[model samples]
Target: MHLNEKVIVITGGGQGLGRAMALFLAEKGATPVLIDMNSQALEETVRLCHEKGVQARAYIANIADEAAVEEVFGNIVRDLGAIHGLINNAGITRDAMFIKAKDGEVSKRMSLEQWQQVINVNLTGVFLCGREAATKMIEGGNEGVIINISSISRAGNMGQSNYSAAKAGVVALTTTWGKELARYGIRTGAIAPGFIATEMVMSMKPEALDKMAASIPAKRLGEPSEIASAVAFILENDYFTGRVIEVDGGLRL
Candidate 1:
């Protein structure tokens, strides 16, 4: 699980938490396969990694597209050799209420498409990537790690029914996959992050961000590097799997 010289796949590696994780892994001498749907952002991440003298590369593909994912992964293996680790980090949030519940209340107004999109990327994508990665790892006899980027919202956010459901599913998948993949010598784990200082959160209204910070016992925004630190911990420890490490400054939601 040492990062040095390991081949790792990081979905949504173009920006946000994914980019930070990729950079940190590369800094530790891991060759990261940066996968994302945004070609431009992917390129930018590669350039940044190169500046840091890390061996990093980018693959442009939509994780929601099965064929695209398979094709891109095939090319990565052909080009980068066997993958030793996978970080299922691609995710999207479509904030909406089940119905027009007053102030993020629960009802049944959420459109089918909204829920489906989040599920496709957050939950199903974990299964797809984990299955594919484990298949290769077993075939290559690689005993490695699989990390899924879950979120505190998995506990149930006020207006994040779809996101919460999908993230919760990811945690379930992490536990399930860990046990199932153990026979193959692969470990699966997840990270549930609290409010971090990603661009998405920074863009929120100042007062809203302040409120979130105040709610956290830490009284501050968690850094992306803190989550990266958690990922490193997960990968480095062999016996820690089929469980989630909540890295949210002690915040439950």
Candidate 2:
């Protein structure tokens, strides 16, 4: 699907990978429709897109809320006339061991709240937004693409049971939606990113960051633009569906 003039919805478009994607698509002539809970950041991203000389708009909504997701997509189609793509990039991390023990005595465990919060936002949010976007795309008679942002942690990281589970579930949804939505001219894909230099990651201690960089075969963190490039490749490639592209700087968990 050519991005020119296409209306693309990006969840978490306020910053990080989402912002990178919005700007990249804008550069390619796509109209970016940003969905984020951060009003100020959303406004800033929209302004940046405008500076790129492309049409852009921002909606403050929690993708995890079913009603909000439905209403937001409805409004996008109502206002934009159509939606050609959606990027499920909004997610959160709640890192905790499933069970933490010291000297055979249980010290702590991942709280149910932690598990539920990550699942609600990372996995369920993707489902809600993807469903609404596909419905709108079908009704508008526009072929569309949905991209889910998974993570290398989906393979299971030591301190991130919740995050890992949610990200892995995202991939499962991508595969199922790819088959189910294909008849409606909708394609589904996922990206599993390794450690990227986003605000959250870069905020880590210098020693920790150095250790992380050393662990990756590339000896560095990935730039947000590299992940954006993968997103663009998925958007532009007609046959790339039901698959995940990894942009992890040669890092594997």
Candidate 3:
């Protein structure tokens, strides 16, 4: 479908892949409704979209909170009249091994707080946003698309039990929602990205980052715009649903 004036809601639209997707969609003539917990960053994203000659609005809300999500989505429906697409792109990681051992004795273990925090934001947040978006689309009789952002680490990465499990669940939700929502004219898909050069990833030591890039077949970190392009493809393709597009530079895990 032509993106002209289409209303697309993007979670975590403040930065990284979310920001890139928002800007790209804006450039394509879509109106992006951006959500982020960081108000300043979200405003900056809105400004950037405006510069692209698109109508974009920013909302500061924690997606994991059911009430907040419900209210924000209600506001969108009230103001925008219909939602054509939604990108469940918000996520966070608290990396830690399930169990840490020292001298054959238990040293530290991944805390419940760490596990719950990641699950709440990464997994539950997606669920909340997806559910609300689907409801709005169905009510509006809008044939819409929902894109979930998974990670290559969903395959089970070391020191990322929580994040891996949550991301894997996201993939499962993408397929399940696709099957259930197809009859309603809503499609669902996922993008499992490899190491992207986001601010958080770039914050690592240069040598470590370079080693990671060397391991990938592409020999370079993927850019946020690459992932944004994948999002556009999914939205534009009507027959694509219930599957994952891995933009991982041939990274196996």
Candidate 4:
């Protein structure tokens, strides 16, 4: 879609892929309504978008909170008119082995907190934001798109049971929503990225990061802009729906 003057809502738009997508979309002339729990980070993203000549706005809201999401989307529509798209990118990772067996003595298991927190934000948050965005799109009587950010870990990455499960759920929701929302002219799609060179991934040790890069057939971590470009393709290609665009560098679990 030509994003000129279009209003797109992006969750977790403070930094990393979310921030990169926001800036790229803004450069395409879309008015990005950025949402994140980090007020300072959100504001910084907005400033960067503004500097790029887009009227971007930031809202501090927890996507997992239904009430907060509703209120924030409401304010977004009030401030920016109709919502054209939503990027469900807000997520967190609390990686842990499902069961740590040390010398056959059952050691540590993934905590309830770890599992619940990941599910709450990664899965539930996507559902909440997609639902709200679809509602507003249908109510406004406009065709729209929803781009969900899944991960290559959805294929069952080691030490990421919680994250993997949640991302798999995201993929399921993407196709389900695509089939269900097509009648309403709202297309849904997902992007599964592998080892992107974001801040979080860069924090790993050099050896570990090098190992990760070597594992990918592309011989490097994917760039945030590449993922953003995939999102744009999904939006512009009206015939695309109910499918996942894997942006992984030919990596298989």
lDDT of 4 at 63: 91
Candidate 4 residue lDDT tens string, 1-253: 7799999899999999999999999889999889998999998999999999989999999999999999999999998889999999999999999999878999899999999999999999999999999999999999999999999999998999999999999999999999999999999999999889999889999999999999999999999999999998998898999999999999998
TM agreement with the true structure for every prediction: 0.95, 0.98, 0.98, 0.98
Residues 1-253 of candidate 3: C-alpha lDDT, one tens digit per residue: 5788999999999998899999999989999999998988998899999999989988888999999999999999999899999999999989999999988999999999999999999999999999999999998988999999999999999999999999999999999999999999999999999999988889999999989999999999999999999999999999999999999999987
lDDT at 123, model 1 = 85
TM-score result, candidate 4: 0.98
| Candidate 3: worst-modelled 10 consecutive residues by lDDT | 1-10
Q: Model 2 clash pairs?
A: none
lDDT of each: 0.88, 0.94, 0.94, 0.94
Any runs in candidate 4 off by more than 4 Å, and if so which?
A: none
Residue range 128-192, candidate 2, lDDT tens digits: 99999998888888899999999999998998999998999999999999999999899999999
Where does candidate 1 stray beyond 4 Å? Answer: 101-108
Residue 245, model 4, lDDT: 91
Can you write out model 1's per-residue Cα lDDT over 65-97, one digit (the tens) per residue? 788878887888888778899999999988887
Cα deviation at 205, candidate 1, in Å, is: 2.4
